[model samples]
Target: MAMRKAKVQEQVVQAVARSNPGDRLVATVHGISGPAPQLTMAFGFIMLFVVKYYFVTVTERAVVVHRAAKFTGRPGDVVFNLPREQAHGIASEVRHGRQWNSFRLLFPGAAKPTRINVAAPWANDLGRLLSALGAAAPASG
Candidate 1:
C-alpha cells in the first residue's frame, strides 16, 4: 500500500511540476470537482457523468486544479488555479448534520470565499492543505 501511494504521489507531482516548472510542489490530492457555474446545486447529480475526478496540485507559488474524466490519468483542462499570494486556508465545515469530506478554497481578501470556489470531496489531507496555505479552517457550518 505504501508503494502504491508513493507511485501515485510521484505521478501527481510530476504532472503539476511539468506545467508549472518554476514552482516547488507542496502537496497534491484527487477529489470530486465542484459544480459548474452554469449548473445549479439542484442539478449536482448530473456531475457524475460530466466529471469523474479532479486533481488538485498545491505548489509553493500556487494552488492549481485539473479536471479529469478518468481516475488514473494526467490533468485535463485547467479548472481552478489560485496563486499563493491571493490564497487562504481551506474551509471544511459540517453540513447536513455531518462531517462532509469536502472543502472550499479561501481567498485572503475575498468578501465571499465560497462565491467562486473549486470545492472537492476528497479533501482528507486537510492539515497539509491548510498548512500550505497558512490559514486555519473554520469548523462551523
Candidate 2:
C-alpha cells in the first residue's frame, strides 16, 4: 500500500512538472473528500462523485495549486508567490464541529490566508509542504 501511494505521488509530481515546466516539485498528495456526511436528504445513497482536489506543489519561488483537470489543458493556479524579503508561514487547524482539517498558507501582510481542507491520509503531505514553505520563507529576527 505504501509503495502504491508513493507511485501515485510520483505520478502527481510528474504531472505537475509537465504542466508547469521549470518549477521544482517539493511535494504532492492525492485529493480526498472532507469529513462530511456522505448521505443526502433526498435519499440514503451516498454521494460518491465529490470534486474535491488538493494538488499542491511548492516550488522555489511560489506555491502552485494544480486542479484535478490540469491534464485536460487547464493551467495550474499560483496559490502564493513568495516575496524576496517577507516572512511567510503555514498553519494547520482541525475544526471540531466539522471534524475536518484545514491547511493554510499565511503570507506577509495578507489579511486572509489561502486555505484548503484535507482528510487524514493527506495530512502528512500537507506537513511536508508546510516544511518546504518554512524553508523558503524569509528569515526574521
The candidate that achieves the highest TM-score relative to the unseen native structure: 1
Q: What ranges in model 1 sit over 4 Å off? A: 1-3, 34-47, 50-52, 89-100, 106-124, 135-141
Clashes of each: 0, 0
| lDDT (tens digit, per residue) of candidate 1 on 50-125 | 5446666779888887665454555577666788776655444422213334455443455754322223332445
Q: Give the Cα error of residue 2 in candidate 1, in Å.
A: 14
Supply candidate 2's per-residue lDDT for 125: 65
| Residue pairs with backbone atoms closer than 3 Å in model 2 (clashes) | none
Query: How far is each candidate from the true structure, as Cα RMSD in Å?
Result: 6.4, 7.7
Q: Model 1 misses residue 115 by how many Å? A: 12
The candidate 1 region of ten consecutive residues with least summed lDDT is: 92-101
Residue-level lDDT tens digits of model 2 in 33-126:
3334333213433443443344666665556555554123232454344432343444444232233345554544568755555545556665
Measured against the true structure, the TM-scores of the candidates, in listed sequence, are 0.58, 0.51
Record all residue pairs in model 1 with backbone atoms less than 3 Å apart, i.e. clashing: none
Candidate 1 RMSD computed on C-alpha atoms after optimal superposition onto the true structure: 6.4
